[model samples]
Target: MNAPTTPSTALDKHTGEPLRPTDGQLALAEAVRNGETRETHGTQTVPASRYTDPAHFEAEKRALFDRLPQVLCPSALLPEPGMAVPHDQTGRPLLITRDKQGEAHVFLNVCQHRGTRLVEGEDVQCSSKLVCPYHAWTYQLDGRLLALPRADTFPGLDKAQYGLKELPSCEAGGLIWFSPQADADFSLAETLGEDFSAFAMEQSFLFRRRTHTVKGNWKLIMDAFLESYHVLRLHANTIGPFFKDGITAGDTVGPHMRSAVGRLEEVEGVDFTDMAALRRVITFAYQLLPATVIVPSPDYVNVMVLMPQAHDLTLVEDFMLIPEAPATDKARDHWERSWALLDGGVFGSEDFRAAELGQQGLESGAVDHITLGTLEGGIKRFDETVQEYLRAVN
Candidate 1:
């Protein structure tokens, strides 16, 4: 017998070649090589239009959400046949189920007749068919039209042609991704690029989740996560002291970014050796393009993905994942402590507060344009990507 060959390691089969870094990315990389650091105070601010313009928001829906390969829903949540999940933001019912042969199928959750929504919850198990509640329209697990209540009442009804509408979907990183538009030519790996696969995301699991409605543009929420410059002032009592001065950041294309906060040796009571050990206790944070932030701490991993609802409202979901099994209670306890600290200190406090303020400022028309300085390389790259995506769609 031949040993199984590993999956192909070439540039993603769909994208043609490895993605190139954007000009903003190249400049950030060069700055990193020169040992440039973040400034204590930002001199440039992002333009308010980036957060407040309705045209820009519509463009984002087309270029970023419709065209990108993002993991909008998790696959594990729909493991069984007959499961249905509703995406309230998109007003599309998402149906997940297995065929008679047990292959997974995903389709838009709407009945072909009169467009009534078919499914209503996170997950549901069905034995053979999904019966629509509105008029008893039934569909097979494979999405073929199974039955109609009044077949003879309607003439020229084509059962073969009236099946459930299907969406383009692919599963990766343990999540189900579907494109809202049918004709989009983007592939998941191609849109995210080859470098994203380097994060070893499959090794992680979900451990904690918090979702909330915030009064802010989703971009404002994302901006809160991209840079650590505010750590010294806003998070001073929490994560500030742990992060040393001289923090640096770099950017990559496809809108992906990387930033690092230094842990120096000169802090008054903190020991570098101990801090290095603690740094291993938490994975470094890396921001995926558009809306996901993944933090791989030594003891646990945390991720946040923001979905936009309206220009002024957003849905933010956060998840914490730890190793499936810890060797000892002490090890498990250590992770628990780290999770609590992060939850209360960062996510629960300063992070959301700053976004709330930024949201209010945009709403109040207090500023028309916010600037981006050399210190905010990550934010600069993010703004540029937003602009490019807007232009691509518009």
Candidate 2:
């Protein structure tokens, strides 16, 4: 894939500068803006209006989903030729399939007959054409209208005018991404940049999955994942003791951010050969622009992408990625066991409950604002990026 073009004299969306400030200056600016007057003890809060305001949510939908590189589906799940996935959150159905010429094309999955949906399930295969289950309207795998049920009944019905609506899509980093709206001038590789794209695409799959509906705002869920500060307190009985309390975060081009939590030297009761070696089990979290977090563990990796359903509800999909091939069953089994513990125990139980409770708090208005400490730097950067996007669209 061709690399994305980076302008030599482009200004940053937030700072409007060709170069960012030094580390110390940046930290100081962050502290001041966040109302942190004290060196390490001050804090500032984001108003509750930012969370509960309907207009703000609408702005987010346009700036983030309509104009960002979002992970729509995982490549492993839709690896077959005629597979299709429907994204109801975006108010459009996604038709993914390989054409007769052996290329992948993604289109708006809607039938011309009364605008009904064309595909329903996952991993479906059709050799000749994709026939609509509703009214038997047929279309070729390449999105050409093949046969309508009653073609002779209509006099001037143009088959050429009623093809499936196509969208710009690309497959990279073992994931499929599509823009829901037109006027997207950037490619997936361009949005992800060359070095990061190479690193992610080079890695293979370990395990993959889709998460159930999570009750919270999409930004709320994303904010929860952006930082590891809550891990020590909320996950105290779970995976908290294994990680350090502090967080290190950095912002990248686009809406992406990378974060790392310090690893604990030793857990009280756990026995391991080398404490230094055990520190290799650090958590690496990468937020892929708008709504996806790629979390890499020592044994495996998991991706959490948020799909907004309403003002206060979202669907979070989780996918696990591993090396292309594993040498031994023991290594694979180890990966699975580790994944189960993290997914079922930590995220599904602890973090999810916290988000729900936080949603309740936001709704209650007991506290008008939510504070972001220095430890939650990634969350602050995410909010700033969202603001930048809204500014662009406006």
* Tens digit of per-residue lDDT, candidate 2, span 225-276: 7776787788887777666443343445455665444323322332222221
Clashes of 2: 2
User: Model 2, residue 237: displacement in angstroms?
Assistant: 3.2
Model 1, 214-306: lDDT tens digits are: 778877777766766676788777766655454464545445665544433322242222322323321245576567776645344566767
Best by lDDT: 2
**Deviating ranges (above 4 Å) for candidate 1:** 1-43, 79-82, 96-106, 123-129, 140-142, 146-159, 185-200, 260-283, 325-345
Backbone clashes under 3 angstroms, per model: 13, 2
lDDT score of residue 41 within candidate 2: 39
For each of the candidates, the C-alpha root-mean-square deviation to the true structure, in angstroms, is 8.5, 9.9
The alpha-carbon lDDT assigned to residue 166 of candidate 1 equals 80
Question: In angstroms, how far off is 137's CA in candidate 2?
Answer: 2.8
